[model samples]
Target: MYARPAHFYARILEAPLHFARIPDKAAISHAGRLQREKKTKELKGESDSTSKAKPWVDQDLQDDTEIPSPNQGDDEEDDPGSELDLPHVPYAPPRYAVDSMLERSRDFYTLLNQRRSVRFISPEPVPREVIDNVIRTAGTAPSGAHTEPWTFVVVSDPDTKHAIRTIVEEEEEVNYRQRMGNKWVKDLAKIRTTWVKEYLDVAPYLLLIFKQTYGIGTGGKRKTHYYNEISVSISCGMLLAALQNVGLVTVTSTPLNCGPRLRVILQRPTNEKLLMLLPIGYPSDDATVPDLKRKPLDDIMVHI
Candidate 1:
């Protein structure tokens, strides 16, 4: 213990440096994946307790409900003021003298309440401009990551509608007979909807809304879209409002077996997934809907 070898002293000096090497995130993730596979294969024979202690390897952890993202451990609080270089603008708005805002809001709510899902649509022709304007209004909805991932396909051609109806009817027949259980059949009985979808032809126009899962970039690389379901749902709601604003009645549907079949019929691109089929036109003379009441505000809302 009087004097250590030069090699031993050098090793002692390098100990802290070894620990201080900046973690290569991509390299660590790849290595971690490989190690995880090795661990999986070894787990059948032996158990290891030091798996979590390795600082160089990122742990792939999951809970019963959800998988935790890798970025969960990132210290975002360290860069509290960090932001993208976006243009700044002064806040400006004209203050209203009267209570028109509140009055208009109440009136709008009342008007929307009167709107109904019309199943029987008259085969009356509507101006193409009306559909275009309504769709434009729907497009104004906010999207996730500014990715406007919605495509509306309007179907007015008689032959296409007939084909879609035929395919949907076939699928719906199978669903009602074998796929759907007794409870489901009983639940649907109140609505009086049958496998035969004659309304497909009766409706002057069919608006098929598709949600884009991933967008293809300039190099044909697929870019992930965030919150596509939420974004499209908001857009659909706005579409309904817009349609109602123009006195057009619509009934939205998620028709059984229609999605894949419709895609083939419509010749849609791979990135889009069918979301809703809205049969839109003037309501029939005896058009009807289920007389259901909406939930009270107290039941739906929680005041904190």
Candidate 2:
């Protein structure tokens, strides 16, 4: 076999070392450029992207540093593990319990069962403190991954209520005339719903429920939340029960036009998705609800 020249062997020995140095040199140069850009932005009174980008880059750098070189031998002294030190944390089980009272539960269920979908509400003003207390009760609901993703906005100002009513009526008019076909109108015929939303303005308070689709953690990273819709719905149920328990009447209004309009009117953050708008107040002195009956327990329940 023919042997390579002495210069060829020299080139082989130097190539690996040069290739290894190239990555380190590139990393250092990139770090320097990032620092320079950060400084330039600071001097110009502009926010630097470095602070926002550093965590990701730093993590990558750390991963790269942990990787052993291809030429490293088993006998060579290993790098110290100080960079990868993880503190020992003691394990502690969660300590929380729910107190169940059968009697109270029975009464609560009974009260909720009496709640009717009131449409003809009185203009009597509901106390602000009552609404606040109801919201506090709702905050105790079990939520997805313990992320209490719900917001209740209580609007009481007459002008704001009037504005909401106008916007809602405009949308409802279009819905009744054009959007909602005859079959849809027929289905709602017995319920007696109208395009004119006088209740929006007449009600003492409009409770807007928002469901947080995602939570913003520290540094604005989105944290995943579980059962966001179910959690919000559960909380809303508890809120309605609490409101009824306090002797205040409420109507769960679902004007198809209200969701988008309320989103614009409230200027809510994008993370918060609108759920439903509830008009809450006292019923009129002579207010009357439809004489409707609910399905029997046997019909709704199945014993498996």
Candidate 3:
């Protein structure tokens, strides 16, 4: 005569709830039949879901049960494997339009060839804007690894240019007297180069080109650059061509002891190596160059 909980009494009144005394053998048989029915229903549901999700089967398997094909719409004729056998279209060629200004290439070459180093420059001042444009033009030159490793330092201050000239002349004097020796001097004689660097001060701008030996990374580690010499030379050539193209005269002047003295004078880092010192400005009225001749095309060219 124990009282049941409220939930237990309510569940007993439900129509689905039934209790009966049965033998152990009959109870076991009823449980086994129920479990078999539940498992069969679960397996059927899984197979149906898998078939709906993945209709395409592996090539090794054949579809035993036939199904209606999807391309049954009869407005137009259709091939069963048309989607899988679509043709691939090739890419079209790029369009290359000729530039109108390209006609001046020959004239530009002639103008550049006429440009010569004027040891004697006029004291006329050049516009800073012009120098900026020239440098920008030089930046367009192709470089090794596209790392345009060059620095153009323009010194327009009279005092700074004068000081630089003094340092350069001192080095040049040593080079001509002691370093270059007689043979080198004789070879340079035809060009009429000397230790007197008066053009450095007279020119409106002194562009000192420096080549970076290597780039500094994090933690002060150095990364070696490829084709540093060739890259710097090409950049210098582009700069010279740009200056000449804009109707400005330029003289490429290289002085000895440039690496040490100029670095100290310019207060540059050790990675920056001095390559060429260009004195750029208008030439004097009496400026002249040697009558030098270039090799003919036939002599310079070879064909296989």
Clashes of each: 0, 1, 0
- The residue-by-residue lDDT of candidate 2 on 1-304, one tens digit each, is 3444433332211212122235677678668877887888888988764454321121211322122334333332121122224444467875534444666667777988889978767788777888999999998887744567898988988998898888888887777767446675664564236877678888889888987765555444444344566777889888988988887887776667466567778887665666778888888787788899999989999998
Candidate 3 lDDT score at position 172: 75
Each prediction's whole-model lDDT (CA): 0.70, 0.68, 0.65
Worst 10 residues of 1 by lDDT: 57-66
Of the two candidates 1 and 3, the one with more favorable lDDT, higher being better, is 1
Q: What is model 2's C-alpha RMSD?
A: 21.8
Error of 1 at 53 (Å): 23
> Pick by lDDT: which candidate is best?
1
**How many Å off is the CA of 72 in candidate 1?**
26
Which residue ranges in model 2 land beyond 4 Å of their true spot?
A: 1-105, 179-193
Q: Compute each candidate's TM-score over C-alphas.
A: 0.69, 0.62, 0.62
The sequence of per-residue lDDT tens digits that candidate 1 reaches over residues 1-304 is 2343333332211212122235586457657876886678587765555344344311111112122333333222221112212344466787655688888888899888889988889998999999999999999987755567899999999998888788878888787777356665665564336776788988889899987765554444444454566678899999999988888999888886567678878998665677789999988888888989999999999988
Q: Which should have the higher TM-score, number 1 or number 2?
A: 1
